[model samples]
Target: MDRFELFHLGWDDLWASQLAESSHAGRLGRISRVERGECDVLIEMGRVRAQSDSQRAQSAVAPVTGDWVTVTENDDGESMIEMVLERRTELVRRDPGERETQQPLSANVDVVFLVHGFDRPFRAGKLERFLVLAWNAGATPVVVLTKSDLARSEQRNELPAVVAAVAPGVEVVVSSIESREGLDRIEELLTPHRTGTMLGESGAGKSSLVNALLNTEVQETQEVRRSDAKGRHTTITRDLLVLPGSGILIDTPGIRAVGLWDAQDALENVFSDILDTAADCKFRDCAHDAEPACAVRDAVEDDRIDFRRLERFRAMAAELHESEQRVIERDRSSRSGRSHNGGKRRR
Candidate 1:
């Protein structure tokens, strides 16, 4: 394979420019998988194992699957990742635990499948959060409702309409691995050279969907709890695989919590109906809760919109506000500490 053809792996002129500063002898490759600062990169020559210095990788940026990086050979002839090219797009969420930081999930993605299963209770609020996360990543968000075979006919029919209401301007595809449904639509989204990732909770049939797409049992699958329909964490690591004759796909570990990180604009975009309704309220800052002349409340009262969805939208708005405040406080504290340390040094 020619070196230039390597660009088919989501590389572009932007990446080429970013790599120009690095050693001219380095080869460009996309990270297929990353584990403990070690990477499996796909280059023009094929797959190669490259080691990334943990300290340096952390200092620059931890490599994630789908990241295009430049690899160089050391004196020992071992491949080492020298630099991570700038990502055209990346999915990031609030860091898990007590830290107020952003955790990048994947980079340079074109489409994001926000998978949810009918086997479990479908929470519009949670799905809205996932949509915001995908939109915030600068990638097109497509809602994938899986396990359709488990749902009754009425539910199976209504679920798509309900999801479509919440996710305006986004595609909602239903899939049932048991019956081989919606696989074609999924394949349609995976255009050549385009990179996509699946983000969903456990038991959402992400692994099963990928397996169906590849026409092979490449990813392991497990059954969810019989009583609750909650699935165990099957895919623990994020892996990027190239489709046999199509685009690249990345399957990520199930995320238990969906936290919003600087996604205010995305929140507005997701709940645009509510925002538009709120605009007609008498009070400019109507909370839409028992406030007189509130168009949003009126719509709910008149059954123009589902009350549950309106409530969920309000809750997400509150969460976004709180997240923004926390980020502000954290930044202020960091600046204060820096100023104090600088003063001590002057003394």
Candidate 2:
């Protein structure tokens, strides 16, 4: 590939300068796939295998697919990834149960498509979690309601408004992957130089939509089971792919649960109307429940805002608050354990 082709893979001067300033002398490459100790990276020359140096580092900073890294040739003429450049945006989620750590799914993405299927269960509360994930990643979130062809006419008409009501400023696309509805509009969003990824539960037709966008079966897809309307893990790993004539797209594995991780501010952004309405509350720190003059409660009573939306907002806010507390406690415990270990060493 030539220098011009590098731009299509999301490389620019900012990345070039970082690689130049680094002590390691090598080519700049974008990681396409990551294994236990090796990864496939795309460089100006071509895709090549490189070893990750993250394990030798003092901290856990392993590279994942979509990361732009500095790769250098070792004495044996093997490629080694030296460092990972700064990411503009990363799609991260809270690791399951009582863990304060986050699992980064994709890096340096411009937009995130939160795919939902009309044929499967549509939970607004679950949608709120995905919205927070997108907002926290610093990427524009677009709600893609897939499987429109299978949806009843009345169901198709009602779902978008309901999704929009919850998503606030986010765009909601109604599509049928089989019939190719809304494919053109989706393609427009995935313009050249922009990177996007899909986050959805199994059976949401994420891979099928990607195939429709690419106009080929680039990713394998399976049908949702008739009994539960659930889909198998079609896309096993989070692999980034270049769209036929557009930007890059990353298809991820199915997500079963969503745990909030330091998304307090994003919650306010997703539920901006509630925050705006709450500003008129009599108390500065109104909880909106049983308060004498809570504007949020008043709005709910007046039917200005749906009560369930407010309730969902409160639930997420509480979840984030608890997550914050847990992180603090975990850090304190780590420090205490370290201090104790140091004292023992001194003896």
Candidate 3:
């Protein structure tokens, strides 16, 4: 296979120049999986396990799955990562309850599948929160409603409308791995060389979906408890799986809490339609509360928008803004501490 073909460069030619900055003079490899301090990389030569050396360590750059990196071999036959290429996209989330750090989920992804189970009715606020992170990752968000077969017949009928209310223009698919329904549609999105990440709460059928796509029991699946309907976390670490026929998929462990950090743009984009409607309001910064001539409130009153959905959006937006402020405050304190220590050392 040619270098481009072996490296899975389908439409990512723009990244070629950025990937050439390594010590190897641009010999590139794709990161398939990362564990602790090492990674499994796929290059033109084939799959090789490698780690970052001291020079790359100085940069504090952590390589996640799907990242293209430059690799070199030592006399001892150990390959080391010299540098990481600029990512086209990166999925990041605020460390849960810790506003000090950003957790990178994946890099260079083309799409994100926000999975949710029908056993528990979809929560508009939670969906909005996930979408914020997805949009911030620079990947298109597609909502996947899993476990459709578990829903009551009447409840299943209302699924489409519920999805439509929360996310407009975002593709929503109802899937049931047992019945194999909607698998083809999901497969179509996994075009060759494209990468996607799965995001959802624990037991939302993410693993089951991966198993279905691979057509094997690659990922373990367990039944949700009848009493609580919660799934056990079968996937302990994030693993990247290459589809036999097409693109790659990053399977992440179940996320219990998805805190937001610096996602103001994403939140605004998610609520753009409502913001557009609010432009006609009397005040420039209308809160959409009981303000006079409030277009958003009027729309809610006239049944143009669901009141619950609007309320959820407002609450999530506020929560994300608050979280961002906390992160900024934490950074300021850290900088102050560093400056104080430096002055003491000089004295």
Candidate 4:
């Protein structure tokens, strides 16, 4: 198979000049998995483990799964990455407690599966948060509702409406690994070579869903404890898994908290409906609080919008702004510390 075929590179026009140039030069491949600091790259030459260039490290450009890169072969049967082709999409989040550093989750992802557990119902705010990250990544977001079999019949009835309210123009699949339901729908989304990552809280059945897709127990699965409905963090790190018959899947360590970073645009996109309503408010810069003729407030009072959902949106927007400020301060401190150390050395 051609390298593109192996990497699931459909839509040839979307591949940028740098990626095409590397491919034409016969040095391009897709990163399947990143382990420790080494990468497992898939090329026309086949899968090989390669180290990233030390020069790239100086720029904070680390390779993650789905990154198309150039690799060089060494005499010792080892390979080293020479360059990272520009990515079409990048999944990132604010590093917890550190705002300035953007933690890259994956790169060049075509789709993001935001998994939620039925047992937990749905947190509208959390769903919106994930959607913002997905939108920012430039990948289409699909909601995967897991543990459907475990949900009470009434809760099941409420699932669709909840999803529709938060994720407009997005697809939602109700799945149950215990019964193998919705597996085919999920499989259809997996085209060979295209990459996707699973995002959700621990015990949301992310690993279980991946295992179901692969049709094997490739990942270790554990039950959520009864006391907290939280699963033990079985998957300690992010790793890419090649499905037996379909596309590549990047399974991430169960995330307990998903901090936001510079997601203002994303938040606007996710809540565009609310924004649209607010646009016609009496005040151009209205905070939507006690403002006369506020469309958003009107909607809330008329039951046209869920007040709780609106509150969630406002809270997330504020949180993201605060996180960005924190990141800025942290970066400033880091630079100051470095300068101080340099002065001491000179003295």
Among the numbered candidates, top lDDT falls to: 1
Cα-based lDDT for every prediction = 0.85, 0.85, 0.80, 0.80
Q: 1-347 in candidate 2: lDDT tens per residue?
A: 42227788888787778667767666778888887779888887888899986445767467888898878878788888888887878877787754788877789888899999998878988888899999999999999999898999999999999898888778998999768888888888878678889999987988888788778898899988899898987778777777778788888888978887887778889999999999999999999998898999989989999998988888889888888898899999999999999999999
lDDT for each residue of candidate 1 in 123-182, tens digit (9 for 90 to 100): 877788889999999999999989888899999999899888879889999898889899
Candidate 2 weakest ten by summed lDDT: 53-62
When superposed on Cα atoms, how far off is each prediction in RMSD?
2.6, 2.1, 2.9, 3.6
The TM-score of candidate 2 is 0.93
Output the TM-score of candidate 1. 0.91
If both were scored by TM-score, which would come out higher, candidate 3 or candidate 4?
3
Candidate numbers sorted by TM-score from highest down:
2, 1, 3, 4
Score candidate 4 by TM-score against the native. 0.86
Q: Per-prediction TM-score, please?
A: 0.91, 0.93, 0.88, 0.86
**Backbone clashes per model, in order?**
0, 0, 0, 4
Worst 10-residue stretch by lDDT in candidate 1? 1-10
Minimal lDDT window, size 10, model 4:
2-11
- Report the backbone clash tally of model 2: 0
After superposition, the stretches of candidate 2 with alpha carbons farther than 4 Å from their true spots are 1-4
Tens-place lDDT per residue, model 4, 268-293, is: 99999889988889999887788788
For model 3, the local distance difference test gives: 0.80
**Tens digit of per-residue lDDT, candidate 3, span 1-347:** 32335434333657765544434543577887888878887777767789766556465678888787878887687888877777788899887646667778788889899999988757778888888999999999999889888889988888877877788889998899979888877878878567888999889999899988989998887888788778788786677777767777888888877877778899888888788888899999788887899999988889987788778778877877787677788889999999999999999
The lDDT, on a scale of 0 to 1, for candidate 4 is: 0.80
The count of residue-pair clashes in candidate 3 stands at: 0
